[model samples]
Target chain A: MSRIEGRFKQLAMQGRTVLIPYIVAGDPAQDVTVPLMHQLVESGADMIELGVAFSDPMAEGPVIQLAHERALASHTSLSSVLTMVQVFRETDATTPVLLMGYANPVMHMGYAAFADAAGAAGVDGLITVDIPPEEVDGINSELQRVGIDNIFLVAPTTPEERIAQIAARASGFIYYVSLKGVTGAGNLDTKEVASRLKLIRKHSDLPVAVGFGIKDAASAAAVATVADGVVVGSALVDTLAQAFAGGGDQAVALGSAGKLLKQIHQGIANAAS
Target chain B: MTRNTEENIFATVPDEQGRYGVYGGKYVSETLMAALAELESVYRMLSVDPDFQRQLDEDLTHYVGRPSPLYEASRWSDNIGGARIFLKREDLNHTGAHKINNTIGQALLAKHMGKKRVIAETGAGQHGVATATIAARLGLECLVFMGEEDIRRQALNVYRMKLLGAEVIPVTSGSRTLTDAMNEAMRDWVTNVDDTFYCIGTVAGPHPYPLLVRDFQCVIGREARAQSLNQVGRLPDALVACVGGGSNAIGLFHPFLEDSEVAMYGVEAGGHGISTDQHAAPLTAGSPGVLHGNRTYLMQDSDGQIMETHSVSAGLDYPGVGPEHSWLKDLGRVNYVVADDDEALRAFHTLTRVEGIMPALETSHALAYAETLAAQMTPQQMIIVNLSGRGDKDIHTVAEIDGIEF
Candidate 1:
């Protein structure tokens, strides 16, 4: 089984919601990413969604967009991101890692080559924000060949028919955008998220992970009630940004990122118990 | 001119799924797929509905001052000493540019779709002014996203949009240009999809947008063709249009795609030159990639990240082109060329001096190309240039370049 699917299955058996922390690779510095991945795992992150920085991150809010700028400014490229993932695999073999970004950078690397490189780097899945199911066949087939999951996002605005369509093509966990806006956008209505997840469950058996509005412990706990996994991006990235602002303190950034991840982890676990 | 009986494959493009020969698919986030599909279905219904056609036609005729004159630039042609040149006077439209054509059609669509708020993105501000104009007339709320740099440069057009009662939001993100403006606009649409109608100004977005914008602007080609038959007695030997997001070019080229003898040229902005990395001539200098909701020729780095594009005119300073332009360039249906900043400026001045017309710097790229192409042909031949907009908004830039404080 792919690493993502296996991780989800294990978490399901344990009655624990998978906690995924998203960090843009090379955000503050190039050397900080691999260590951050290991740190995240130690702090209770079940999987890592490493963002590949693109020049134009259209779906991102200001927080994540600044993170991308910082990553790009550090001379980060897809190849370097893969190298970081490979290094992370050296110490941790069980934690799943998924690359999340836009399509242009992946297309620049060529689909087959990217799939092979990602698989070799021990990457578990990919979530290209702009590539809908209608346009993902080329990359999807390549990822499938490499045993890497091709995860797709199901938005709150997505209709039932499209949810079924996306679910059919998606492997690993399906990312449900918990709100109607960018990554950092607020106003997450639990009732609305629950209703959407119910419809999504009717269409697919894959684990549903909710992202894009689960900012704090309360929000994560609220989502954990109806979701198999929870993803927190902008809030974590914002923490790292604060560290960078506070005199480029890598230790502080790592500590704060871990602290935030642990709080969300406890939130989910506490709600479950 | 040589003619071939090859069957025209250009008539039916962007098939049911919006694939224009491996380009122009709906490469958006899943949140936007349903909205795009709904728009496609609504446009399909209205495109054929008799009442809707009548309403659009009436708007084009009376409201937008359609059938903009096809004026022959005899003096400019005489100065060039070659092919006769005719200008499709899109500059004479109500909003002083070809942008109003698409805005009017989309505003009408928004009204029909029962959308109360309309949004648009602009680089040079002409499109913003046009959208604001239409939204004001239709009594719909309007918001325009413009890059910070463009808002500073095109202050007059920004003021015009404000005078028309539209809110102009300044985008302060990456590159701070048209591309960023588009990114901001997309975020707004995704957030407010229920009541907001995104009236795209160019032919570069996802499926139905490129298709819809092209259909709305095809009045240029349709009129040019009829005028060619009546005034020139035959299709022109060549057609020329500047391609930014390629709306004006597609509008002027779509109707003549089947005409074997009609040569077409799409002039891209070569800010410095295509050899330098400082130009916006993607079709000439860049490669195919997916960006801004479609796969097209993009100015990008080796890693596929979009590169900052440069041009004298903000309207033409975008990294990506329309997917249809990409397909056409590959099929050898249209000759894609470049005009550098200096050449476009020269042509801008030449047109003003010789033809008593001041072309927008974006449109001057086409005129620059036409000047070169016209000089190579005999006087018996004719070339039609799409005067896509007027240069009134660019007077300050020109004055600054000339070291005059205006």
Candidate 2:
């Protein structure tokens, strides 16, 4: 099984919801990314979402967009993101690393070349925000051949018919956008999320990881009820941005982000118990 | 002057998934796929719906001032001393441009689809003004995204849009031009898909958009065609139109795609010149890449980073054209040309002085191209130039360039 599918299965058996913390690789600093990947695991992350910074991230909100800008300012590229995954893999082999970003950078690297490099770097999956399943020809099969999960997003507006179509090729848990807006735009409506997840479940056996509007421990915990995994992006990225902006020292900022992740972890576990 | 047959492929295009020979597709974020699909279905239903057509026609005739005259520019043609020139007077349309045609058609579709709000991105502010006018007419809320740079350049248009009840939000993103405005508009659509209808200004974006915008603006071609048949004994020997995101050019070219005898030219904005890195002529200076949700020729570097494009006219400052234009370029059907800022300015002044008509800088690109092409052809031949807009909005830019202030 792919690392993502395996992790989801393991979490399912344990009756535990997966906590996925998204951090932009090379955000604020290049060396900080690998360390942050390790820090996420220590803070009880089930999987690591390493954002590959691109010039234009259409699906992103202001927080994530700023994160992308910071990462790109640090001169981060696809190769650099893969190298971070490699460094993280040296210490942690069990945790799956999903590279999340727009499709242009990956397309620039060429599908076969990127897939090969990603596999070699021990990357587990990819979330190309701009590449819908209908336009997945060049990269999807190539990524799958190298054992990388091609994760697709299912939105609140996604109809049942398209949900089934997306579910067919999707792996490593579908990222269900909790709201009908960009990340960090507004609050999540858990009841609406639950209804959407129900529809998504009818089409795929894969785990559903809810994201896009999950802000804090309460929101993440509420989403963990119906979702198999919870993704917190803008909030975590915002935390990193605060640290990089001299709001506090690196250790304090990282520790505080870890503290927040720990709270989210406990909240989900508390709900399950 | 030599080219292969365009292969009756217009009918077979955008197969099941809205692709044009591996060009156009749903290369958008997954959240937008459902919305695009829903739009495609609605458009498909309304495409042949006679009720929808009747409403659209009524609005076009009485509201937008459709069947805009095909004026034979006798004075300008006599001055050029070449081909007899005809101007497809889209400038005479309500709101002073052809943009109202697409905006009105889309606004009607927005009403038909029960959307309560409409949003659009603008560079020249013509599309935004057109959209806001229709939205106000239909009682739908309207929002327009304009780049900070463009809002400053086209301040008159910004005021006009505001007067028409559109909230003109300034986009302060990369380059801060039409491309950035489009990005902001896409974000808005993704954010408010429930009540918002994105009235895209041109023939770009993912799937049904290029097709939808083209069909709406084809009223230009349809009218010009019938008008030419009645005015002249035969079709014009050559057709010319300016291309930004290429809505106007595609609108005028799509109906004539099958007319093998008619030659077509699409003018791109040559900001400085093709040799310099300052121009926005993507078809001539750039290669194929994906941007703004569709695969097309792009002003992007090797790293897939979109390059900053330049143009004297804000409307022609985009780094990409519509996907269908890319397809047509590959097929060698339409001859894509360029008009540098200097040449377009010359055409702008010449038309204003010789014919007493001030054309939009965007439309002047076509006029500039047609002037040169007409100077070579015989007077017996005819060329129809799609005069896409009026220059009242551009008078400030022109005045500033001439070292005069209001």
B381-405: candidate 2 lDDT, tens digit per residue: 9999999999999999999999998
**Which pairs clash inside model 1?**
none
Show the lowest summed lDDT stretch of 10 residues, model 2 chain B.
B1-10
DockQ of each: 0.88, 0.66
Model 1 misplaced regions, further than 4 Å? B1-6
Question: On a 0 to 1 TM-score scale, where does candidate 1 land against the true structure?
Answer: 0.99
Q: Each model: TM-score of chain B?
A: 0.98, 0.98
Worst 10 residues of 1 chain B by lDDT: B1-10
**Model 2, span A1-273: residue lDDT tens:** 999999999999999999999988989889888878778899999999888877667778889878887887888888888898898899999999999887777887789999999999999999988888878878988998998999999888877888999999898789998888887888888889888989999899999999888888888889898899999888899987887687677787788789889999999998888
lDDT to native, each model: 0.93, 0.90
Residue pairs clashing in model 2 are none
Docking category for candidate 2?
Answer: medium
The lDDT leader among the candidates is: 1
In the range B178-210, model 1's lDDT, one tens digit per residue, is: 999999999999888889999999998998999
